[model samples]
Target: MTTMPRYLLSVFGPAARTDYGPYPSKEDMLQAFADTGAFNDRLQREGYFVFADGLEPATTATTVDGQGESPVLTDGPYLETKEHIGGFWVIEAPDLDVALALAADGSKACRGVIEVRPFQTAESVAALLDS
Candidate 1:
């Protein structure tokens, strides 16, 4: 017997997609939100969704590093880049092909790139420890 592996789909893109300006129209924003919601519904109905969400803008983030007793905090992202993660999803799939297929849809829904990564299971960790 086999168990399906859990995967994470990390969505990345610019804060906004505007070729001529800094923001999209209110109607376009609402439409995108609605489309994303409908896409999430499809994932849930298909049993592929475990969890998913969009994140607040990167400007509201704080980065922390170092030891717990004396951790350092920074005001911005760890790396300065044109693109940042806007959202993510946790899903279960039998293999990479299936996961990528789902990720493709996710990319279309969010109008961004999706990075697919498989989660490490406890069984694999235990086996590694015993080795």
Candidate 2:
């Protein structure tokens, strides 16, 4: 059996804010939410959706480091950057072009910039391990 290619559509925005972009009013924000909901429904109906979610602000994040003898816990995002991933969607597509097209719609729906990346397949992982 052939497996579909999985891609991650990450929504990026300012780390300080939970919302995607500047909304002039509450109605605008509600409209954005409605559009995003419609997009999500379309994805599910089309059979390309795997999983999707919006993340909280970077301030609410906790970082855990367990590589050393004792684990250390940090209260915040792992990276201190101007922008962070505010949300993400995991989708299965036939190819990169299709994934990119979907990402375009997703970006518009969520009113945020999106970064599309493909997940490494099991075969690719095994090849890397062997090398």
Candidate 3:
């Protein structure tokens, strides 16, 4: 049987010093999204683009507790580290090579770590689709 081609584009970044920019200001990234609308539209037409989106800043995030006295919800992320996950995508491609090539283009275009991960089996993906 032929397996479906899917990739997870996990956009990672060095959360420490220096600038991660669409250049001019904090909203510049938003502008970039608006500006790339045409490019993205064309990608969608190609049938290789399935879905895409972004994430909130590393701040303004919260962590959850599962087992405890009260299932205690925390006020922020569980941990802090430099490599922050900024955003991601689920795309359709022919194979790993094509997925990685797209990841390279995404990495350069966004100037961040565009990680291309192969989708796991149905068991793993079911949780995502169900939600």
In order, how many clashes per candidate? Answer: 0, 0, 0
Q: Single out the weakest 10-residue window by summed lDDT for candidate 1.
A: 15-24
What is the lDDT for 55 in model 3? 70
Q: Relative to the unseen true structure, what is the Cα RMSD of model 1? A: 3.3
Determine the backbone clash count of candidate 3.
0
For model 2, residues 1-131, the per-residue Cα lDDT tens digits are 99799999999976554243445567777997899999999999999999999887888899999999999999999999998888999999999999999999999998889999999999889999999
lDDT of 3 by residue, 12-70 (tens): 87655335332455576665565446445755887778888777666657787877777
Kindly report which residue stretches of model 1 are placed more than 4 angstroms away from their true locations once superposed.
1-3, 15-23, 123-131
Q: What's the TM-score of each model vs. the native?
A: 0.81, 0.90, 0.70
Model 2 RMSD in Å is 2.0
State the displacement of the C-alpha of residue 37, model 1, in Å, after optimal TM-score superposition.
Answer: 1.2
**lDDT of every predicted structure (CA atoms):** 0.82, 0.90, 0.71
Which of 2 and 3 is ahead in lDDT?
2
Model 3 — TM-score against the truth? 0.70
Screening candidate 3 with a backbone cut-off below 3 angstroms (N, C-alpha, C), the clashing residue pairs are none
Give, for candidate 2, the lowest lDDT window spanning 10 residues: 15-24
Question: Which 10 consecutive positions of candidate 3 have the poorest summed lDDT?
Answer: 15-24
Better of 2 and 3 by TM-score: 2
Off by over 4 Å in 3: 1-3, 16-39, 123-131
